[model samples]
Target: MSLKYAPKYRVFLFLIFCIIKACDVLFIAYMIKLMLNLASSGSKDVTELIKLATIAGIGQLFFTCSNFFYEHLKMTIIKNVNLVLKNANLNYLVAQAKNDTKSGLSLMTNDLKQIETGRVTAQLDMCYQSILFIGAISFAFINSWQMTVIFIVASIAPALVQILTSRLITRKAKVWANANADYTQHVSDSLNGAEAAKLYNVQPTIISRAVNSAQRMEEALRSMNFTQAWALEVIYTVAELFCFIIPCTIGGVLMMHGQLKVGTLVLMVDLAMNFITPVVTIFQEFNQVKSTDPMWKKTLRALNYSKNPHEKAIDQRDDFIDLKIDNLAYKTNKTNTEIFKDVNFSVTPGKKTLLMAPSGWGKTTLLKLMMGSKSPSKGQILINDQNLTNDWSKLHNYFSYVNQKPFMFDDTLRFNITLGRKVSDQKLRQVIHEAGLDELVKEKGLDSPIGENGNQLSGGQIQRVEIARALLSHRPILLADEATSALDPHLSLEIHETLLKNPNIAVIEVAHKISPAEKAMFDQIIHLNQTPTD
Candidate 1:
């Protein structure tokens, strides 16, 4: 049930796992013997037999407790792995390293989930139960090895059927993994853009996609379930028929020659009954255990996603000065669709700079690179001649960025403004005033729940809210990406004044609003020409 990606715990846990399984098999065999003896013509020692049974039960109890404790410990390990993954900024890391969201998501979700399913508890439980069954077979062999051989020979039929059917289980599990991803994508697409889907008459399309996702998931699950059930039934029917066939044929032959006692005959019948459950259980759970390999494989596939700088190396704060780029180049893909080549620029402290580019000239790409996203394919971005991209903590802490489409969390004005941080209420008032959020706050107090992504607020209100959140960071250097595009002239003028005359603020606005006085706001400009499509 464990994956190839079994954490370093494997070196120790494997041995413990085996010991726990061995204990269970021993316990089950003792119980089987006790039951057979009870049904035999023996009486006065019933109390002794029950006492032995109690001891067996107690021993099993100890193993069961150990099973749970170790399982819980394993869960802790998994959670620790999650923390490591989260700290590693696995999303950004995987995006940069694997460069594929689908594969990354699979590794994070389906792969991790499957790893959980391969719980050491479940695996050990099955393995131990199988061990008990084989123990019963061992008991039968002691009494009559020839009959045991016949029993095992009959077992081969089920094994053959299982081997042939295992391929189907694997195929279905794969389909299930794909279906799960599709369903998640559908849910994300629909929920993230519910308002747009509704307004643009695309709700039906989203619904159709959702349905397809769900149907695919259902179909895959159904196929797996049906195949498993069919396989089990075939094995069970054959097993049940042979259970009678073996004992009856062997017992009758012995009785005809007067070679067996009634007690031995009765014991054989009891042995056959005892053997049926465990043997079938072994076969069935073995298939389940086998199926788990793929699940673990899927999970490990995600956990094993390649990454660089496996740990956080920098958290620089409050030391940022000039934002300088040196011979930077970046590509969009492996085939060298270079977005920027040898681009160099600097925005000094308390100085404003403009980055202008015609459509499709990698303007946004450059902006993203500066903001700790979309890393450059070549060269570096520096703060005080030391790399900012290498350690964006100072750059991040000292600067605030505004994207073209602002994001809003579904929370109160207080939470939206402070983002769950401990900021003085007085600062909130200033941010609301500076960002001109007074009207929104006045209409509904700070406690008001903003609808999902600020859908209830206008574009301007959402932008202001995002700005208010940024102000809470107190970043000295601010970058705006067409942030004021939704605002009217009057509001734009007020925002421009705040950026320009704000005593000690270094602000760079990616302006789309071309006002008469706009040129004076920025100290430098880099005009970028449009790219000609080939």
Candidate 2:
């Protein structure tokens, strides 16, 4: 899977390296055979040995140089392939409307590691081993065809072992991959909930669950490793019995009968081992590559998803005349129960509307649908009298969202507020003032770092930063979902005033609880139960 992403020229270069390696092996074997022949001939001159040693030394040097380039090319290809895969994985996660960080982490880390070793490296090894096997067999056949035939016949056992265990190895690999992902999720959950667990005195429960997940993960890994090892062991045992012992015994008998020269018999035995080793190795590599089927399929799916049409250019606008929902409805897939039914609403430029609904009435869900983070089960959302598509990339452009918990990356305040967009300092300052974030800017400056999820800022200040983001975006509609619920009364009123005072921006805030005075600031208020308030 990853090999396809490797540069074509680099792959060609690597294949050339494999051929050179095979040639080097054959040359070394030939040198050894010549040395054995010299010894068998009862040569007395030390000069001939010296000459052979000099020639073999030069060959060894050339082989070492070829090996260095070979290893360098292998790593280069692996690096290039991994880069492509990681980028595709990142784009896929970012393109999602609601991404699971834990799942993404698992994919990028655990699954990717498996694909690297089991699929990419294994495939490359098979190529190298196959070429080397061909060269060795050719050498052996040149020396003694009868010995080569015996070696080939005996090699069938290793191939059979690989075929029989391929499915079992793949199953084990898949189980290990799944268990690894589960363990990652559990560890993340345990850490994220550590504070709550401590407060509730449930540390023991959390520890127990984490331990159980870890144990399961290790057990799966053990199973996978043991299966792979056992397969290799069987292959090795078969190779030793059939290719090594049988061929060496037959070569000795042939030599005793003078059917083969002493030097030739020794060379055939060495060549037999050479070809046999590659046969076993190729089978091992094939099984390893097969084990990554599940992970490779998952990676391919993500790559395809990242290249989806929806990920292409989408509509971007700074203003909308009106946003309306007509007979908007949503229901749960599991229970077929409506979270909200026949919901109707509309917003025009500069109009401030408050949406009131009791808890469990799907106010947040309705906001999600309007913001395009979720799709409606029925009806359509119209913008400027044109129906909107289900594509969030296009639908989300006309609105800015401020929910109860605004997400923030670990970055500078400026980047967090503007989201890495190129914004003029003048415009930035104006929005910061409008959002009542002037005090924070005055104290910390825009370049100050905001910790992850804005933990560096107070609840009220984080809400103000969210407002600053919304205002800076110049999005016409502000969809605030319990945006001030986390703040105190004073800060809530202040946030509400800042949100409502923007005459050019329409505001649609949904909340079940708000001070009456704060609620009265809206130009119009509508209840989810079809009630209206002045």
Candidate 3:
């Protein structure tokens, strides 16, 4: 849903506010006219003055109450719109095949805030001011048509200025948004790699890079602010000159010539000010909305993104999985260089397959392609002779993955192992023992917390915990990308033995180094040689 849908009841509140505000303006004009007439007649009736004051005070009360409700409703609408924008952006991010989280993060945090402060505020201001402008012009025409005509003529120049500079403001806004995204991405990259920076003693270099990013962001923002300021100053200056100064001068001359009564002149001056107020306010609001146009367009684009219609959903109960890759290939977009080509492999349930490749031979990339995290530039991956079709969710249900470095949350050992799944104590103990995690569980009870990313545990222990998680998932296929790379040879052999002996699951592993004895135990060993470009 669009942000406009959020103000379900606020529209009615705004209308009530406008009506009461218009009536208050009319009452004030009448009170001013009465006071002028009394002064002209040299009359001293204190009771008449007290009655007018009482009526004016009552009008002020209603105006204030309406305004209170209006402001409250406006705030509520802003908050609701913010929430809607965040959810839309989040859904879009989740649906993306390859998402740039840094850019998305900046859009939700910075761009959304800009929409709230600039676009939403400008819209509300324009709405309120439009009503006030119409009320003022109607009242002024009733008092003196000549003065009302003068005010409209004065407003023409500011309106023209707004038309002339709108495109420039929008372009500047887009530049600022892009620069902010780049800065956010740079900072996120540095923070994620802070440990490496410290280890390499390159903290100064990282800080320097961050400073450069910040400078670029500041430059873009300064340009946007300058353009907005210049536009606002020109419009406000012209509006003030004609709408206020000229109207007051003309009214005074008419009163002096006896062409206008003192009371009429007072009413004309008040209405003239009221008419100019909205015109000036609208000019400011126009600039604000223009500046926010780019971000709003980005948000709209994200909200309207459609998911892939060709994505197929396989039945979860179909557990017989046989992975077959036919002439698979991949290339990098930036360099247009192939990582691998014409690769053929097959893995079936109840067998152990070892994928052997040298470093930088795209072993991990191949694993990702099989898991549907990345799509091949050539060939198709099939399960049970049907095309896998790059549906990660369907593949996710059939396979469990173990990376060289597995991610762990800062939670208890048992919580990390089960991952919030309701597994019986019997199954949990079985998997823990099978994956060689029994000793760790005994040393530190299941309730004990593992630090962030399992930093408290040794590399072997972390790898065992990851294997335990995969074993407990009960998926038919297990894809491991150097799962035992960090473990000692004996532990690695033990883990490999446990996985290979599992009769119910297929184990496909990428191994960099293995002994002759280890190679003999696998059902099939596929060695990948890098394909040279023709």
Runs off by more than 4 Å, candidate 2: 307-319, 389-391, 422-427, 530-534
* Superposition TM-score, candidate 1 onto the true structure: 0.72
Assess every candidate by TM-score.
Answer: 0.72, 0.93, 0.84
lDDT of 3 by residue, 1-534 (tens): 233747667666766676676767877998889877877877888788788888888878877887787778778877787787888888787677355867788888888898888887678777778888888899888878998898889888788888888888889988998888888888987897899999999999998898898899999999999998998888888878877788778878887898888998888778777777788778777778878877888788877876667555444366685788899989876787888888898888888899988877889888888878887889898888888756676665677888888989899999999998888999999999988888899999999999987888988788888889888888888888988877778877777787788787898889778867667778999888744332
Candidate 2 local lDDT, 328-388, one digit each (tens):
9887767877777777888899899999888778888787788677788998888888887
For 464-506, candidate 1 gives per-residue lDDT tens digits of 7877776667766788787666778777666666666654557
In angstroms, the error of model 2 at 13 is 1.2
Comparing 1 with 3 on TM-score, the higher-scoring candidate is 3
Candidate 3 stretches greater than 4 Å from native: 5-7, 11-30, 38-41, 97-101, 309-315, 329-342, 373-378, 390-397, 408-475, 490-504, 515-522, 530-534
Model 1 lDDT, full chain set: 0.67
lDDT for 194 (candidate 2)? 92
